[model samples]
Target: MRYLLPLLFLVALFAMLMLRGYVHNEILADHRIRPDASTDTVPERILDGGPVIDARGTGKPTSLDIPKHKLVLTFDDGPDPTWTPKVLDQLKKYHAHGVFFVTGANAARYPDLIKRMVDEGHEVGLHTFNHPDLSYQSHARIDWELAQNQLALEGAAGIRTSLFRPPYSSFADAIDDKNWPVIKYVGSRGYITALDSTDSEDWQRPGIKTIVKNATPKHGKGAIVLMHDSGGDRSQTVAALDTFLPELQGKGYTFVNLTEALNAPSAHTPVTGMDLWKGKAFVFAVQVSEHTTDVLVGGLAVIGVLVFARFGLMLILSFLHARKVRARGFRWGPEVIEPVSVIVPAYNERECIANTVRSLMASDHPIEVLVVDDGSTDGTADIVEAMWLPNVRVIRQPNGGKPSALNNGIRHARYDIVVMMDGDTVFEPSTVRELVQPFGDPKVGAVAGNAKVGNRDSLIGAWQHIEYVMGFNLDRRMYDVLGCMPTIPGAVGAFRRTALERVGGISEDTLAEDTDVTMAMHRDGWRVVYAENARAWTEAPESVQQLWSQRYRWSYGTMQAIWKHRRAVFERGPSGRFGRVGLPLVSLFMVLAPLLAPLIDVFLLYGLVFGPTQKTVVAWLGVLVIQLVCAAYAFRLDRERLTHLVSLPLQQVLYRQLMYVVLLQSWITALTGGRLRWQKLRRTGAVEAPGGIPTQRGSKENIDRRPVA
Candidate 1:
């Protein structure tokens, strides 16, 4: 009897769904009026949300009637690459743009074409991540659906979206409680503008002319026209826009973005006279707090290792890494045509500045070394001046910071090819030549040199040793494989002066000026290169205090750079095509990779902290295997010593905590609107050790030549 009841319910539900679908599809769609209409039809459809179609001073009256000659020709559920292009061609024929409510997944597939619509001055608005009934979705899914679409589509269309029309307009509106939460959520995410005008039930199978004829009522004002460009073959819809847009233009009407038409009233206008679209901002929180205990225990293990025996291990690893570089036997290939101008920015480093200058002086590549003293009070300028080598020049300036120093150097450098390096870093003899040689291609805007720790005598050094060998080098390689070299490591990166000038020089708006500059180069349509063969040695933070200070700036600075140039990521200009499409995506990664990445930490912590149990013990064993593979991979990438393997667990624990701590601090600082300070850390504070070039690979093999990029 119970089974029979359930079966009856299922059958009835299916029958009702079929009945509803048939009737819903059969209903006649309401007609909408466009702005570029003849003054003839004016008695209906001026609808809610202010002067329809921004008719201000066009002498068009509000709350007026619909126009008979007015036509809203629309395409919906598009854009297919093949057919969308055809449709765009047809629209271009008539100089018209339509409101496209696209599905999110398809939007990602044809990014360039979508960008084309925006570039041609058309409107591209959101239609959600996929075609889903909002009422049936959970609160989280609703927000994700909208956010993913905004991130992917807004850049393509070049317009910030405000018009949000439901798939069936009334599907969620009718479902009361089940759907309103989602609508409310979308509003919260800054999608408050609703479409009052609906046109074209083109999701239906209809003749091309019929789709156009049905929407072209005699006349109405401020009507939002809806169309699909991608549901099925939309050749007909494309053809209709071809015919109708010009006809409307001929009739003295103009097309505009739906949101612009509705919400963009003058500030002086009264609330009743103006329609202001209101929506909430979207927030996504990937939850992983269920494994808190494990994180604490793993963190303790990391601290324990930091307190002892870490330096001896760092020395061993650094030695091994240098040996690997030497084993490559000095990749002696061709000569670099360009003699490079290497700019070293020194803030207050008195200890390492002298050695860095000496290392570069030994380089055989025809080079000019400019030490930019950013108001160094620590005698860094004195040390450089004391060297007094003819090629070594010190430019003392107010402590405006790295970007300002680089900008200043850019004006003074006579050479077209410029290499920028940190004052704390020491380059190998041929490193400058290796880093510079890749600019044979005119498009190559910048190049990155591999950075290894010069002071590997502590846990900090060991951590950096592992980082250089594995994370830094490997991640960069992976990025290259993915077709982008993310940030050129700030220690030693080179750029062409031409590209720098094109992007308005480096901005002081960011803390990590290197990342900001690199991204700007891409935006200017230039290429960034990574040269694994070119290596520089930089001292790591030797203590907790030092580590925190450097990292705080790094983290906060990254956030600033991402924020400052975020607009360039997707909007196109001479230099912004790459930046426009790339910056937002990279920012997304910088934001998400941390919060969602902790699941792996959860798994590791489960094993490390609670591993007395059999399951927990098994997980720890798995961590051991993963760590070993990571160690070897890290070594291969950067050529580090074998000693980093034993210190892997402690390093991982500390690394995770550092990431979390920095992330939190960045958020707090951003919220408080605090300026990022340059708090100097102890540089020469490494526990004493005998240091030299990683092998006898320190030969001063110079190739004297003139600079050419």
Candidate 2:
């Protein structure tokens, strides 16, 4: 393959890459890249995610825990001299509270209306300085619009909005690597989207009841109903709030500020911690707007055309395997009976080895446990050998890390199908069964198990759990549906014996052997599947220190893998799938994501810091409010999602920064061409399991005559 030759020579080229410099600090000096590392407040400021609001005090304030329904009457695009005063009257008439998102321009024109918003118990927020096509504006222009309007809102009313709504709710005008960082800037502006749970369209001159019906929620909790008090002739909106406020209040709904109800602890009791909102908008955009299908297909087209195979034979294998899959009718039997070689590379894993070995034993599939005792000073080999497990076997050797140990085990492995799992992870009994099910088709080369967080109650674990579920799970499904599952995860992977042997077994050049094997499988013409239901419970780094170390290794390992496999960069087989599709994916993830992140981040900051023209910081805040809403929405989505996706904004501020650090460290190491030897994480916490049943082998005569894909 064209990719393989360059890859084998990659480590040798490390000196040249290093001479190029590890850190792209030029961007930092130019002020475009902020590492999110230093605490120094340079000219750079990350997007706070919403309008800088006077959230004087906010944290997990007591939420309104009562059974009563809590609703928010949110009016957007207002502070209108023509209609807002009248709307305030109706709100007062019912003695109810509401939130008014005022346009910065309108607020400048009508200061008293702005004052009335506060004086009448209505919270004032920004709708934008002039409500332009938010998407079309550059980050600089977005900031300018926000700043200009922020000044108007603050000047007119003594209030400084801690929340904002973009004029048109256009998420991002551009979808480029350059605009991703700006997502953080805009998000810091506010809490959620134009809380348009209700749509009055009062500007359209709808009838009074029609407007009211359009603006009111159908009586539910956590409903932040949207109505228009401005933006156009909003007399209908003014009257609608009047009509529905009393009726809804009569039905036991109490209205509160956007910062309240959801944060409040009791019915009618406000959520007091103002600082609770931390919106992070993780934006992903490109220069020109494109449809989703076009974007996805573009990747395949670009990659397929860009790469050629390094080895002709491997390319042929892929062609044959993919062809075989398309022609197969693999059936699902009542039980999966594939004999699997369970490869466990243990080093000082005495505590975890038995448990790890025992878990594999519990799986319903036929498994022969092979614990390769990589030089454990703690007598891990003795422990495993002592177990004398009926299904277990131990091979002790000098400590050579995981890949070396796995290599030793692979040579001695007894079965054609092998399952490799981390010693520290636990699995459901059905895990092995599910992992092997995809191989019912002979064409299937490998499968990655869904890794869920076992310690989710911990803050970091909860955060990562959300990430694994939403990110890994969703992307896997999306890729699987697309027939291109990249990056078979290291935590748990299943592979075919023939495929691994053909590729010379797991190479030790890359730290991420899992990723290496996955690429090899693709080159060899086997499908990589993500079995979401096949779950593995693993521990996440509980502290930042552990998080950093773990990520550093993963990142460096990936770089090494990329270097090792550079030969596959642009090679295609007669079928052209591996060269065209698979190799390109490697470049997208390995080369592109890190390269583009810094440029995009600083480009957004140029708008927020230098050009937003914030004679008053309030000007930039209104746009930030929108960011907060988007983040809140992201959070809610993660909460309800099966993959347990975390709030994109939160990850932007926290996890994304981690990526930057890892990238920098890995790049430096690559340049220096250093052998990595980082401290290993010692497992302290684990979920104790109940006893599980070990697998029993069946007679060879029972093997089915059905063809493997």
List TM-score per model, in order.
Answer: 0.50, 0.48
Of candidate 1, the 10-residue stretch with the lowest lDDT total is 278-287
Worst 10 residues of 2 by lDDT: 278-287
* Top candidate (TM-score): 1
Flag regions of model 2 displaced more than 4 Å.
1-336, 386-388, 574-576, 598-648, 690-709
Residue 487 lDDT, candidate 2, scale 0-100: 72
Residue-wise C-alpha lDDT for candidate 2, range 515-619, written one tens digit per residue: 777777777777777665577777677887887778778778777776666666566651246546655555564455543343223323333444444532352
**How good is model 2 by TM-score?**
0.48
Estimate candidate 2's alpha-carbon lDDT, on a 0 to 1 scale.
0.58
Off by over 4 Å in 1: 1-335, 572-585, 588-591, 595-612, 620-624, 685-709
Error of 1 at 299 (Å): 18
Which digits, one per residue and each the tens of the lDDT, describe model 1 over residues 1-709?
3124434633553343332222122121122211222323332333332222223333432332223333333445556777788877877776665556665555654666767876765666566666666655667767766765665464344335554555545211132333334444565555543343445565574876777665454454434555667767766676677665766577676665443443353111111111211111110000011123235346445433332222323335444544543575443244456677888888998888877877887776888888888888988888767655546677788898788888887876879989988888888888888898768767788888888887776677787777676656655554443335668887888898898888888778778788788877776677786777788888888877677678778778888877876677557673465555455445544543443333445545434433335676575556556556756865865656687677777776667566655665666677678777766776782322123322222234222211111
